[model samples]
Structures are given as C-alpha cells and as structure tokens.
Target: STGGGLADYIPFIIFGAVALIMTAVIIEVQQAVRKIPIQSAQRTVGLRQVQSRASFLPLRVNHAGVIPIIFAISVMFLPTIVANYFNAAPVDTWYYKAAHWIQGNFAPDTTNLPMAITYNVLYFVFTFAFTYFYTAITFEVHDVADNLKRYSSFIPGIRPGRPTEDYLAAVMNRVTFAGACFLGFITVILPIATAKISGIPHNQMYLGGTAILIVVGVALDTMKQLQTQLVMRQYRGFIT
Candidate 1:
C-alpha cells in the first residue's frame, strides 16, 4: 500500500506553526498601543500644547484566540483518556460501556452524527463561556475609565466618572458578545466544513479555524499601525 501522504500530517504542522505565530502576534499586538499627545485646550508652559503624556490602551483581539484552540483540542482528546481507562476495566462492566460510549461518541475524528452534534454543541458552549471569562479577566473597565478621566477625554455624550465607566462597560459587553459568538461558531463549524469541502478528515480542522482568526486579527492590527505611521508621514493609507 502507498504510504500516507505528508498532507496527512498537515493538521499537526498547522498547529505547531500557529502556536509559534500566535505567541509572536500577541506580543506585537500588546506593543501597538502607546500614549500620544492629544492637544488640549490648555497646557503647562514650556510643555507641548497637548495634555499630559499617558499610556494609550491597546486592545488585542487575539487575547484568547489561541486559548480557545487549546481548550477545544484538549476537550476533544479527553475521550482518549477515557478510552484508555475503559480498556483496562472488567469486560461487560457498566464503567466499560460508559467509557466506550464516550470514546466512540466524543472522539473528534469520528463521523457519527449524534456524537459530532454533541461535540459541536459542547465546544460552542465552552468556547462561548471561556471567551467571556477571559475577556472579563483581561479588560479593565474601571481602569480605562480612570485613565480617560485623568486625561479629560470623555466618551462623546458621556459624562466623566461613573457614566463613562458605564458607557465603556456597555461597549465592551456588546463587543464581547459579538466576538465570543463569532469564535464559538468558527470553532464548532470550520473544521467540519473544511473537512467536507476539501475531502480532508474532520479532526484536522479544529485548530485551523482558530489559526485563521488569530492570523487575520494580527494582520489587521498591524495594518492599522502601519496606516497610523503612514498618516503621520503625510501619506495616504496603503489601500486608499
């Protein structure tokens, strides 16, 4: 029989590459935000007309991008552990049956419709939950509000203090919801769809979905920074 093609190992290669690229992307994304002078109506003598120098906020979309892939892949493989445990159990025992069921149904590679559906549902739920959890841990609404207040930069139509905090929180809430849902959908469906469309096996797609998002997010952010640099140089954006 002909040996399996190298493409058969594409998933693992993709995973490895993504892991490295994501680490680099996250660090770069973090560096993108920096404080710049926003000229104020009033300023200190000898000091530039701009307000006090402060650190600008950098928002990284890839904050938890790799996290979801890691979790999903881990959960998908958990049934393998269950399988090993069950294989050692006494034959015909309930535990054995339960383990077999889990292995067969929850294994990410199988084409069993029921198991696939169940896995997708669980994946989506966990991804959604983790997305919010991570966002909450990372995004500091109070701190952002404080910084804005210190700089006297209020959200348009929002009063400084509690109102601004509330406004920022609301904006984050909406963004978190949209972003979480998008990630959840991609995590659940992209792999399955890629497998079907490309004639590749299903499990291969799990990490691919997450990789695409991270790469795209980093690329967009880099473009934004480059555009900012270009504008500073009195040149138009690359696209227009």
Candidate 2:
C-alpha cells in the first residue's frame, strides 16, 4: 500500500515541481525591465555648478501582470458557464446539443485533442488581447512624457514632449507584445505539456499554468513594493 500510495502521488509531485519551475521562470521574466537613460538639466549646489545628472526610467515587460490573466479567465469561462444552464433541455433540442458541444469543447478539459486545441487557441487569444488592453489603460505614455518634461529630464537623443511620448509608446507596444506571448504560452501550453508528459488527467491537474502565473505575478509585485519601501526608508535615513 505504501508503494502504491507513492505511485499515486507521483503525478502530483511532478505537477508541483513543474509549478515551482514555472513560477520561478515567470518571476525572473517579470523582474526584467528596460531602463531608458534620462538626463536632468544642470543644476548648482551652493557656490559650485553641477553637471546634468543621469538616471533611468524602468519599464517592466509585464506591467499588466496578473490582471490580464484574471480578465481572460473570467471571459473565457463565460461561454461554458452559460451553456451549462441549458443542460436540462432535451438531447434532441438545439439548446441541449449546443450546451453539450460547449461543455465538450470550450470547457477546461485538456484530454480531448480537438477540445484542447480549441480551448487553448481561444485562451491564448483572450490572454494576449487582455494583456495589451490592460497595459494600454494603465501605462499612459503621454503622462510619463509630460512628467519627464516637467522635471526637465529628457531621454538621450529623443526630443521632449510629443516625440518622447511617441517613442515611449513604440517601445511599450514592443515590450507588451513580448509579455503577451509569454503569458499566452504559459496559460495554454504549460498545462497541456504537463498533462502529456506526466500522464495525469487534465481535469486533475489543478496547479495549472494560469494559476501559477497569477501566484508568481502577485508575489513579484509585492516584492517590488517592499523593495521600493526599503529604498525610500534608506533615503529618508540619509536625509535625516
């Protein structure tokens, strides 16, 4: 019985290991940021003059983070959920047949190749779409450009104001695309790979890629906040 129990738990152990690896990879990817060099206008301190100070604006690849995953999952499940309500209809009826079809195809079961393909395709599309959508809403290029202009800071070689905004927008779109692709791959492909490799039932694989992504993304954001707070405290200590 002990040996049998261990064999039964093998799939779960594999799933957990995969989850840990996925989380680590996601966190590492999330930590990667593109730093744009900026220079502040020259200033004077007391009787002496100071040269322009250099700094950088850090832009994260996964700015939208888990929000996109949450949004996509909520949207993706609506069809299956709505179809389930018509389960009581006669099998010969259109609604019953439609509901069954949705349950078989759109539902979150990776065992069926055709259903898995359909579901993953839609999942990828929705996740990618929401990543771009959420990023667009949260990361405002014009605001960043305006703030930089107000602070008398400029990206090296780029003109301030409209040109700067355009440049930032272009860079952000490129980064967002990379992030979205990663999210989609994680959300859809990872679970399928786990099931195929581990010989685990798709329905029983609860530690899916989407869940891992959300967990890791939230952890990374929380760590970033704590680090920022620590930096602020250190700076305050220096000032006092």
Candidate 3:
C-alpha cells in the first residue's frame, strides 16, 4: 500500500497468491524420476554363494533443479547490466550501438514481443545448457559403472565393463535431456504463462519458478531422508 488503503491491494494480493500456487504445483510435477534396474550378482561369502538381489538406481528428472535457473538468470542479466554502463558512451560509436541493442533485446519485459522473444530464447538455452553441464559433473557414468563392477552388481543384459558405462551414458543423456527441457520450460515459459493466465505481473509478485523448484525439491529430499532414518531407527535404534 503505497499511500493507498489495504482495500485497494486485496485483489492484487489474491491473484498473486494464486499465481504462486500454480507455479509451485507445476514445479512439483517436474520432480519425476527414471529408475534403472540393478541386479546384484551372486557373490561368494566364506564358502557360501549368496543369492542375487535386485535393486534400482533412481535418476531424478530435475537433477539440477534451481541451480540451472540461478545460473541462467545471472548469465542472462550480465549483458543488460554491462550495457547500462556503456550507455554514457558516444551513441555514434559501434560499441555504443552494440550496447544499445543488448539493452533493448535483453530486457525481461513481457509486454514487448521482440524483447520477450529474444530474452526468453536466450534464457531457455542457457538454462538447458547449464542443467546438462551440472548433471554431467555431478553424476559420472564411469564411476557408477566401476562401483557396480566392484560390488558384483551389473545392469541386466548389459556387460560388466565398458558396455555398462556406455549404456549408463546413453540413459543419462536421455534423462538429462528431459531434465534440461523441463528446466527450460520452468525458467522461461512458466512465468510468462503465469502472468498471462492470472493477469498478475511477474515483476510485481513473487511468482518465481526458482523459488518453487528449490522449496519442493529440498522439502521432498528432506522428507525422504527423514523417512529412511526413521525406518533405519525402527530396525536398529541409535542407543545401541
């Protein structure tokens, strides 16, 4: 309420809240994962051959989550910020013209068709690229394959050595591609869609897709860890 009464802000508040709720729900839906089956082969245990056991490796669809969004936003604004510094330069100079172009096209103004298209396109590309880069660094197929080989575990129908790595790499690429697309959609499209459907301006509200992604991802991970701890405690108490 900037000099206005609380009554004047009620409608804005209501619509803003609804838009944020929608963003949260959409981000939660993107948390799905692809599970790869893992079979632990029989291993000799002190003159005994233990039976094989089956398990699965869960690879999250939004493995990078908020990280890519944060990175993309930071990179997306770099040119805009830099261009502002050069606005004092001579307008006739080539560098000044370049800076002017950057400032015009890089703004996140949804009402402007050309600026919105250029900004969102770059934002999506940056988010997609960052997701794959972060995923690769975090999840290494070579290490996963080596660990499986050492533990007498192997993916069904896949060999134990290089073939296993190759298969894992292929699956990871597919999963990462899906993750990249989801990140791109969440970062670039979700906000625009929210603004269009709810009639709420994004700059005036807290309808951040990154906020929902981080909150839902962290909440789910914490809950899963807590549940596992509780289960473990039920079988083996902490005291002894």
Candidate 4:
C-alpha cells in the first residue's frame, strides 16, 4: 500500500521537476529582451528636471513567438473536419477516396516517403500562413506607438505618431515573418532531430509540436511576468 502511494506521487514529482526546468529556460529566453534607451520628451510629476532612467525600452525578438504555431494547429484542424464529412459512410465515393488519400499521406502516422513530403509541404504552408495571421492579431504596432507616446518616448530617428507607428510596424512585420519561418522549420525539425538523436521511437519522438510551442511560450510569459513583479518589488529574481 505504501509502495503504491509512492508510485502515484512519483509521476507528479517528475512532472513538477520538468515544469520547473522548462520554466527556468523560458525565463532565460524572455529576459533576453534588448532595452533601448529613449530619453523622455516631457518631465515627470516628481522631478523639477526629469530624472528618470529614460531608458529600458523592451524589444522582444520573439514577440509573435509561439502564437503562430497555435494558430496553425487550430486552423489546420478544420480541413481535417471537412475531410471527415467526405469520409462519412455512403457519401460521395470520390470525396471519400480523396479524403482517404489525404489522410493516409498527411496523418501524423503512415510516414511513407511520399506522405512525408506532402506532410512537410502542408505543414510549412499552414505554419507560414498562420504566422502572418497571428502577427496581425497579436502584435499591435499602434498600441506600442501609443504607449511610447504616452511615456513621452519616441524612436531616436523616427518622428512621433503615425510615422513612428508605421516604422515600428514594418520592423515588426519583417521580424515576425522571419520568426514565423523559423517556427515552421522548427515544428518539423525538433521531432525529427529528437528521433535521430535519441533512442525514442519515431511515434513517441513525435512530441506534439503545437504542445511544445504552447508549453514554451506559456512558460516564457509566466517568467516575464514574474520578473516584472520582482523588479517592481525590488527583490531578488527567481533562483530556479
């Protein structure tokens, strides 16, 4: 009975340890923000001559980050549902056959060479497309511009308001596109690489690409929030 109790607790312990480690890694990544100093144009309430750091603007490289992956996973699932309607019994034969072919070729299993190629192509396209979609949804250049303006901060070379917003949006779009492509490659690459490097079976090595991205992204966000809290409170940051 005691041994059974111990066994039950073991899995939780293992999972907790992994979560902690993942969290640490995420924090490290998020804290990699590059802070660019922009002196404030207006003085603050307390200061006669504004004496603030007037610096520490955060530039998040992975701003769009794993959001594109989530969008891809969610959007890609809909096609499968449409295919399922065709696959229903006593339905159109050609539709069923086409659905079967697509399923056989692209379902995460049945990785014949041809199927693998098709999967890669579809995966890349969906990932890339959703990346753009997610960037538009998540990264609001206007918000950033507004925040900067409210703080009396503006980009060094760019004019304030609409011009600054446009420049920032352009930069973000370019970076987001690059990040999206990288994620697309990574979605396919990590599982394959893990399979090659580890003794895990291919199926097991297929460690849920979307899941991985979500886990990493959530962990990173949590860490950043924690870091902000610690900074506000003027305490030592996390040890683990």
Q: What lDDT score goes with residue 136 in model 2? A: 97
Residue 22, model 4: lDDT of: 44
Model 1: residue 113 alpha-carbon error in angstroms: 1.3
Supply candidate 2's per-residue lDDT for 195. Answer: 87
lDDT of each: 0.65, 0.87, 0.82, 0.66
Report residue 55 deviation for candidate 1 (angstroms): 13
Give the per-residue lDDT digits (tens) of candidate 4, residues 111-155. 688777666667778888877776677778799888888878887
RMSD of each: 8.8, 2.8, 4.0, 7.4
**TM-score, prediction 3:** 0.82
Model 2 regions lying over 4 Å from their true place: 1-10, 43-50, 88-91, 110-112, 228-240
Best by TM-score: 2
| Top lDDT prediction, candidate number | 2
**Mind giving the per-residue lDDT tens digits that candidate 3 earns over 59-148?**
877777678888898998888898889999998999999998877666777557887888889999999999999998998889999999
lDDT score for candidate 1 against the true structure: 0.65
**Candidate 3 Cα outliers beyond 4 Å, as residue runs:** 1-31, 87-94, 110-112, 228-239
Q: Return the TM-score for each candidate structure.
A: 0.64, 0.85, 0.82, 0.70
> Model 1 segments beyond 4 Å from truth?
1-63, 204-207, 213-240
Query: TM-score for model 1?
Result: 0.64
Structure candidate 3, residue pairs in collision? none
